[model samples]
Target: MSKAHELLKKYWGYDSFRYPQEEIIASVLDGKDTLALLPTGGGKSLCFQIPALVNEGICLVISPLVALMKDQVDNLMKRDIKAIALTGGIHADEVITLLDNCVYGNYKFLYVSPERLQQDWVLEKIKNLPLNLIAIDEAHCISQWGHDFRPSYTKINLLKPLFPNVPMIALTASATLDVKKDIIKQLEMQQPKLFQISFARENIGYFVYETEDKGYKIEQILKKNPEPSIIYVRNRKMCHDLSFQLSQLGFQTTFYHGGLPKREKEKNMHLWMSEKAQVIVATNAFGMGIDKPNVRTVIHVQLPENLENYYQESGRAGRNGEKSFAVLLHHPSDTVSAQSQFIHSLPDKEFLKTVYNKLCNYFQIAYGEGIDEQFSFNLNHFCSQYQFPVIKTYNSLTFLDRQGIITFSQEYSEKIVLQFLLESKEVIRYISLNPQDEEVILAVLRNYSGIYDMPTAINLSLISRKSNQPEAVIEATLLRLKEKGIIEYTAKNNDSSITFNEVREDERTINRVSKYLEAQNELKQNKLQAVLDYVTDKAHCKNSLILNYFGERGTADCGNCSYCISKKVTKSNSEKDSNVLLKLIKEKPLSSRELQQITKISEEQLIFALQELLDNDFIKVLPNNKYTIN
Candidate 1:
C-alpha cells in the first residue's frame, strides 16, 4: 500500500481505489503531464487530490466554480487536511494573505479560479512557490470545441514556463476528440500520455420528450419521481418562475443563476445541499461545479443551445451509481429559440469594434491607458455615457472581455481613486524632485482609510471633491506615484475586463488587431458546433459514436442507450410473428384464435409465434373474445 492509498483509506474512507486510479497517480508521481478524461461520477477528484497529499509540495487546482471550491475544501478540512479556495469574492488583501499562507502554511491543496491567473500578484506569487503539480479541472474549457470556452483559458500555457520542472494534470469528465487535442495544444502539454475513459453512463435512463405545456409537463414529472431533482431553464427569470411553480406544487424548490448576488447564490446552494430545497431550478449556469451524488433526476424544462450543454447537464444525475432519469422537455419553439440565440449572439466584426470603441471612449480611455488597474464598472453607466442600448453593448463588451481585450467585472463603474502609501514626511522626500505633490499628498492622506500597508478602497470622485482638484490632476498625480514606485491604483469601470497599457499605438493598428480577434471567435464557434453535431445525433450507438468522433477504431455500439434498447425490442420480434399478430387482431372476435392461426401453420410453430408476440405485449386478448394491437 502506497502513501496515496493510505490517505484514501484514512481520510476519504475508501479502502481501495477505483479503476485506473492507482495507474493515473503513479504516472503523476513519475512526474508526467497527464490528461485524465473520465466519465462523470468516476471520482476524478481523488486521482488528483490523493497524489497532492502524497507528493512533496502543494497542488494548485484551477477551477471556475466557487461552490465547488468551498465544497471540496470543506470536505478535505473535515478529514483533517489543509485546503483553501481563492475566488473573486474576497478582498485583494485577503487573497494576497491566502496566497502567502499557501506558500508558508504547509497546505496541501490550493484551489483558484481562472480569473485569478490573470492578476500580476497571482502570477508573481506562483513563480516563487515550490509547486508540486498543476491540476486544471474541466480542462475542456481550454478547448474551442467544448461547450464552455473561456478565452483566459487560452493563456493557461503562460503558466507552463513558470513551473517547467513541475508535472501537471488536466482533468475533465467530458471532451470529444477535437476538444482533447485543443486542451493539449492550449496547455502545451509535454507530449503527455492521455487516459480517456469511455463517455458512457449505463445507469442513467436517457429520455427526450417533446411537450406543448412545459410547466405542466414539469409538474407531471415531479409528481411521479419527486426525488432530488434539477430543473434547468435557459434564463435567470425562468429559473425563478419555475422554482416558484414547483414550490407551489408542494415541492421544496430553489433557483440559481448569475444575476443573483454571490451571497444569495451561496445561500441557495447551501439550502440545496441540506435538502431544505430538494430541487434546484436553475439555468445552465447552476451545475458546473456541483458534485451532488444523489441527484435522482435532471429535467430540462427548456432546451440548451446545443447538445454538448445538454449532455453535460444530463450527466450530473445518478452520480452515486444508482438509477437516475435525464429527461428533456423540449418543444418545437425551443429548437427555434436555441437556434435564434446562437445566430443572434454571433456578433459581427464591425459591431464589436464600434462597441469596443464606445466603451473605451465612455471611460475616456485612449488607445493604451489602463495597465494593471482594477476598476468598479457598471454596464448601465457606459450605455448611458454613450447613449447606446445597454443590452447589446453589454453583450459586445463581454465578447471583447472574452476576446481578452478588456475585463468588465463590476456591475457599476466608479471613478479612478488612490491613496498615499507613505506618510506626509515620507511623501515630502519622495516628491522633492517634482516639488508638486504636497497638496495632493495631504488631500489623499486626509481621506481614504488604511493606505499604508494594504491598498485602500478608492472612489476618485471623493478625492477630487475633497482636494478641490480637477479629475485630470488627481488621475495624473496617482499615475505619477504609481510610476515612481510609491503606490498602486486600480481604475474601476464598467465594460470589458481589459487592461490597456499607457503605450500608444496608431489607431489603424488597433483596428487591424481587433479584426483578427473577431476572426478567431468566428472560427471558434464553428468548431464548437461541430462537437454539438456529435451530441444530438440519433443514428448511431452512443459509445461507438463518441469513439469514432475521437478517431478511435474497433468500436461497436454499446447496448445501453435508448437506440440500442429500441433495437433490442425490434430484434426480439420475428417479422412473420409481427405480421400474424397484425392480421389476427384486425380479423376481430377471434377467441384464442391462437389455434386457428396454428391450423394455418404447424400447431407448435403457431403457438411459438403467438407466445413471442404475447411476451413482447404486441397484441392484447380481450375478455370479449377479441384480439387487438397493444
Candidate 2:
C-alpha cells in the first residue's frame, strides 16, 4: 500500500482518498510545497494530513478560524493520532499545557491561528519541534484581494525557516486565479506543485430567482428536499424570523448565528448535526466549522457581497456526493437594500477614531498603554453609550487587530506579550544553577530568534502556564529567557488601535475606496439584474448561464428549476389565481384571510400573488385590511 493509503486507513478508516487527493498527497510527500485548490466538500484536510503523517515529523497547520482549528484537531485525535489546537478559547494555563504536550509528547498536528503566529514565543517554540511540513488552510486569506484577508497571514513568512527542510502545502476550497496568485506570492511557496480540481459540483443544480415573496419561495424548495437543508440569511434577525416563519409553516427548523448565546448556538448546531432538525436558518457565520454530509440543499435569501462568499456558503450542500442544489433568491429591490447596507456599514475614519478614543478613555489609559489588560466587551452597550457608529466601529477595531497594531482578539485569550527584560549573558549564573529553567530558556533561545528587540510582546501567560511555572516564575523565566536570548514579552491591555499599515490619507482616498466599494455594490445590483434576466430569459439554457458565471460549462438544464418546469406545469395556476382574485375583489372588498379560505390557496402564496397584482395596479389593499380590484 502507498504510505498515504496506510495513514488514511490507520487514522480515518477510509478505504481510499477521494478524487484529486492522492496526487496532492504524493506531491507533499515528496517534500515539495504544493497548493491544492479543491472546491468546498472536496476534503482539503486529507491532502495535507496524509502527507503530513507520511513525513517523519509534525505538521504545523496555520488557520484563521478558531472553530475550524478545534474541529480538525478533534477529528485527528479521535483517530488516536495526537493533535492539539491553540486558540483564544482556552485559558493561558491551558494553552501552556497544550504547547508543552505538543513539544514534549507524541503529538503530530498543531493547529494555530495566524494571529498566534505574530507572537514571537509561539514562533520560537514551534521552530524546532520536528516539523516536517507546513500546512496553510484557508490559503485564500493570504491574499489582500480575497474577501477574508488577514495581516497576520503575512507574518507566516517568519516561520519559513523554522521548518526549512519541511515541505509545505497550502490548501483552500475556493480561490479564483487572482486569489491563487496572491496566496502564492504572499506565502512565498517556491515553485510549488499546483493541483486544481474541477470546481463544478455537477450534481448540485444552480438556480437564481427574484421574488419579493422569499418565504414562499423558500417554502417551495424545502418542501421538495425536506432533509438537512440550510437557509442562509444576511442578518441575525432574519435567522430568527426565517426559522420562526418556517416553523410556523410546520417545518422543524432551527436558527443559528454568532449573536446567540454559545449554548443556544451549540444546541441548534447539535440538533442539526444529529439530523433532529430538517432545516437550519442561519447567517453566513453558522456553517464555517460544520462538516455534515447529506446536506441536500442550500438556499440563500439574500445575495452575498461576492461570488467567493456565495460559492463557499452554497458549496456546503451536496457534500455527500449526491445530487443537491444551490438556490439564490433575490428581488429587483434587494440590490438597492444591499447597497444601502453596504453604505451604512462603511463608516468614516473620524467616527472610528472617536470610538477608539472613547474606548481608550474608558479604560483610563492614554494612547498606547492598554497593553495586556482584559475586559468583557458588550459591543452594543459600548456603541450606544459613546454615541459612535456601532457595527462600523466594531469592524474597524477588528481590522486593526488583523493589522497587528493593537490586538482586540485578546478576548479569545488571556493575552500577554513578554519582553525579554534582560540580556542573554546577564542570567547565565541562574540558568546554570537551575537546569530545568535552563531547558525552557534554551528552548526559547532555540525557537525564537529576535530576542534583542525589546518589548517584543510575548505570551508569558501561555508559557508560565505551559511550562508549569508560576505567573511570576513565568515572568522571571521570561526575564531569564531574555537574559539567555531565549524569548521576551510585553502585554496589550484590552485597548485596540487601528494599525492598517495603511497610509493615513486625506478624505479623497477614503472617499475613493468607498466609491470603489460603491461601484462594486452597483455591480452586485447588475448581478441581480442578470438574475432578473435569467429568470425571464427564454433564449438559451437558463442553467448554462448561471453555471457559466460559476465557471462551469453547459451540461444540461436543471429539469427541476422553475424555468424548465414552466412548460410542464401548463395549468397557468399563477395567472388563474390572479384572475380569480381580481374578479372576486372587483365585486366587493375581501380580506386576505377570506380570499385564502375561498380560493383554497396557501396564505403566504396568496399574499405574494396579491402583492404582485397590487404592484401591477390590478388590485389595491383597502385601509380596513381588505383587497379591492383596481
Q: All candidates' TM-scores?
A: 0.67, 0.71
Write the residue-wise lDDT of candidate 1 on 334-418 in tens digits: 6566555654456566666677666556656667554435444656666686776655566566565554445445322334545
For each candidate, the alpha-carbon lDDT, in order, equals 0.68, 0.68
Give the Å shift of residue 266 in candidate 1.
4.2
Candidate 2 colliding pairs, count: 31
Judge candidate 1 at residue 90 and give its lDDT. 53
Off by over 4 Å in 1: 9-13, 62-103, 107-125, 149-155, 158-162, 361-367, 375-394, 407-630
Question: Which digits, one per residue and each the tens of the lDDT, describe model 2 over residues 470-536?
Answer: 3445555555555665544444443222212222333432343343343333444554455455544
